[model samples]
Target: MRIVATNPDQTQAVGKKLAALLQPGDLILLAGDLGAGKTTFTKGLALGLGIKRNIKSPTFTLIREYKEGRLPLYHMDVYRLEDGGAEDLGLEEYFNGDGVSVVEWASFIPEELPAEYLEIRLNKDETDDNKRYIDFNAQGKHYEKLVAKLAE
Candidate 1:
């Protein structure tokens, strides 16, 4: 599915909607460029998960864990990771843990990813500074159902 966001708020709203459909062990792979509002969308997901604390990108830290929400949110940014660094982190724990995982720059660690996941790709609209084009692609039956629900 393709979604158009006129502003950061809209992008976040989209994330909020997706959050409602998330389940434990769910994986969401986010792909986008710099200043693409990936963190903004994540903040909305945090809110939807019942988290109230401040949310920030984990670019330098590699991963940020939020447990206050209904489900734990393991937000990861592997942008700085080298080829084998992701393996050292034992990412499987989070991906298979009792929470939802959102990986930013997921392409950096494709080999570490699980068999099923929801991929969200965000792109800036060339004509509008605040506009974003978001695409959602499912990799498994569960994710297909989730995307179908989002469509409804």
Candidate 2:
């Protein structure tokens, strides 16, 4: 699905709707540039997941685990990862484990991703500062189910 978000809140709202469809062991690949409201969308997802703690970007820490929610949320930012560091950081464990993993700057660690996952791409529209074009692709049956759930 493709969505045009006029403001940060709209993007967050989309994230919140998507969050409701997630299940344990699901992987979300977030693709966007800096200041594309990726973190804001993540915060919304955390909120929908029933996470009450402050949600911060895991830029330096690489990953932030929030077990306070119904299902653990492993939020990761791999933007700072160097060659071979994405896998080295033990990201695969989170992807295969009993939690939902959302990876920001996911393009940097494409090789570590599974064949089936939800890829959310955020793009900036030069004509409108508040505008973002988000493209979502469901890669497998798992994601297809998510898309179906989101449509509800």
Clashing pairs in 2: none
List TM-score per model, in order.
Answer: 0.97, 0.93
lDDT of each: 0.92, 0.87
Q: Model 1, 23-131: lDDT tens per residue?
A: 9999999888999889988998998999998999999999999999989999999999855588899799999999999999988888999889999999999889899
User: In model 2, what lDDT does residue 8 have?
Assistant: 89
Candidate 1 residue spans exceeding 4 A from truth: none
lDDT, model 1, position 73: 99
- Clashes (N, CA, C under 3 Å) per candidate: 0, 0
For residue 149, model 2's alpha carbon misses the true position, in angstroms, by 2.6
| Per-residue lDDT of 143 in model 1 | 95
Instruction: Please report, as a residue range, the 10-residue window in candidate 2 with the lowest summed lDDT.
Output: 81-90
